[model samples]
Structure formats: C-alpha cells, structure tokens
Target: MEIPIYIFYALLSAIFAALVAIFGKIGLEGIDSTLATTIRAFIMFVFLLLVSAFQGKLKGGITSRQFAFIVLSGVAGALSWLFYFLALKTGTVKAVVAIDRTSVVFAIAFAWLLLGEEVTLRAFIGALLIVIGAILVSLK
Candidate 1:
C-alpha cells in the first residue's frame, strides 16, 4: 500500500520538533527562556514569510473571520512555545517533551468537541496509550 505524503510530512515535523527540544534546552543556558522563544519566533516568522512568498502564497484575500481565527491560532501557538521554552529551561528534555506530546490527546478531544469530528475506538485507544506512555516517560 502506498503511504500518504502527509505521513511523511508529519514524521518530518516530529523530527524537527525533537531537535527543537534539544536545541532549545541548550540555547536556554545563559538567556531567558521567554527571550529565546521570542527570538526563535522571529526567525520562524521570517523563514515562513520567505517560504510563502517564494511559493506565491503571500496573497491576502482572507475574510475577517478567517483573519481572526488565524490570529487566534498564532496566539495559541505563541503561548505554547513560550511555555514549552520555559519548561525546557529547567526540565529534562524527555520529560518536558513527553508531557508536551499530550497535545495530541487534547487535539483529539478538541476536534471532536469543536469541529464535530468523530473519534473512532481505535483512535481513542491510541490516545489513551499515548497518555499512559507520556506519564511513564515523564516520571522521575
């Protein structure tokens, strides 16, 4: 069976996210976590802006509702990063990241509630196991 391209993209995102934990922890050695996160966010903004421009995706035609949602999403993401960096500053990478990965479980629940998406039994089981695994990994 052919694998979906999205799976590959997801895997790549996981890899880079792992690197973020490692690198962010190291980079937090002498500076404040919030400062580090701000700098990192700036770099990310520039990189994504360049990529979007390169792909001709910089056109602005979104409605106010769409703009509001996008801004809210950005705010949520920024808060996530700020807290993540703060955690990484003092916590073990494995423990911090394992706890952070619980976002997947949250996403599942949120999707079902907010987006009216169906949660299958298999997916529920997977999310349950992920919670268990994260707890085990996060334990001292």
Candidate 2:
C-alpha cells in the first residue's frame, strides 16, 4: 500500500516483463501469438487462483457487485492483451513496453487530481522523465 512498495512492485514487474518478452518471442517462433497468449493466460489464471487460496482471501464472500467488477476487470484485461499482442506483432517488445509503462503518468495525474494525493516534485520529475523516455523510444 505504500508508495515505495508500489515502486518496488513496478520494478519487479518490469524484470518479469523482460523475461516474458524474450520467452514469448521464442515460444511463438512457430505457434500463433494468440495460442501462446492463451497458454500463458491459463497458467497465470491457475497461479493467481493458487495465490488467492494461499492468502485465504477466497472465502466465498464475494458480493454480486464484487463479481461484476471482477468480470469487468477480466474484460478490460482481455482487451489490453488483444492490443498488446497486436503491438508485439509489429513492434519490438521494448518499444511496446516503454509506451505501456507510461500508465504511471496517468496514475500520477489521477492520484493528484482525484485522490488528492500530494504532487511531489520527485513524482513530477519521474513522470516527466518517463514520458520523455517513451517519446524517445517511440521515435525509432
């Protein structure tokens, strides 16, 4: 829940993501990207379920509203994956990831405006650098 924890998580996500790109590129050498994605999704689903059970968080207490939101989240995830796969087909994984990671900018802006979070100079600087880096990467 802390900001630093989020940053650590993001860094770890980036590391895993690099591995994903390399592995996916190799895995899809002959198979279609869609098939590869489906396989990965299934594995991820199983792992997430196991993690949820391990955390004792799946006590069959989900409300209908929670179920709705969970389904919506899954829908959004699928849509995101569709676009990501399409991007991977045409662009280097690095470029796609660079652009995708700019979601941090949106998160910062949203927190500042909607959540009333403090807009620290460090956060502003980091967001600026990230956007500029993404632009540089996108320029070819």
Candidate 3:
C-alpha cells in the first residue's frame, strides 16, 4: 500500500479505537466486560469474514506456526482489553486511554530488542515524545 493510504488507515483506526473505548465504557454499565469482549470479537469476526469473502480469500489453511501466532495475537488482544475495561471501570476515560497508549513505547522497545528493528535516535526521540504526551494527558 502507498504511504498516504497507510497513514489514512492508521488515523482511522486510532479514531475508531478511541470511539470504541469511550462507548465501551458506557455500554459496560450493565454488562460484564468479559462477555462484552466476546460479543465484540464475534462482531469483528463477522466483519472480517465478510471482507475476506468479498476479496475471494476465505480460506482456513493454517499451519502450526501461523496458528501459534494467531493464538498469541488473540491472547495479547484479550489481555489488553481486559486491562483496558478494568481500568475504565475504575478510572477516568482519558487517564485509562492515555496510559493504554503507552504501548507505543513498549512496542518500540520490544521491536528494537526482540525483532532487531532499527533503533535510530529518531525512533527513541519519537518514543520519548509519545511517553511525555501520555503522561501529560493522564495528569489530573
């Protein structure tokens, strides 16, 4: 994909995610978080399935390695959501979200150390900025 297209997708994803967190907190007023997560998963699965089908790529030929990766992704996603919802339950939305977005710093560090991604000074500076912004947003 083109660079602009990727940026567009990222922007939309971030916006949608922020909206999800806000609405999710409101919707969780009378529902269990775990159940709510499962329902959201079901909805996402359906949407993804439709997209795959429309693209003529609906196939389930998963190898063990691919299966493991998928499982790990799902586990990480569930854990993240669990913590997000729990935090939202007890903390302010802005604080919970700002803290949660700290994953960008974590991602940068892990990618550098584990995946051997390039650890340029620029990347370090960007991560620092993200952390600073998160801290400022979470301040009372």
- 10 residues in a row with least lDDT, candidate 1: 58-67
Residue 98 deviation, candidate 2, in Å?
Answer: 0.9
lDDT of 2 by residue, 72-117 (tens): 9798777776666666766787788788779789889988898999
Query: Which pairs clash inside model 1?
Result: none
What TM-score would candidate 2 get against the native?
0.75
Q: Is candidate 2 or candidate 3 better by TM-score?
A: 3
How far off is residue 28 in model 3, in Å? 1.3
Clashes in candidate 3: how many? 0
State each model's CA lDDT, in order. 0.97, 0.82, 0.88
Q: Give the clashing pairs for model 3.
A: none
Q: Rank the candidates by lDDT, best first.
A: 1, 3, 2
Winning candidate number (lDDT): 1
lDDT of 2 at 78: 71
TM-score of each: 0.97, 0.75, 0.89
What lDDT does candidate 3 reach at residue 40?
78
Residue lDDT tens for model 3, 32-120:
87787778778888999899999989665889999998999999998888778878877789988988998999998999889999988
Which residue window of length 10 is worst by lDDT in model 2? 81-90
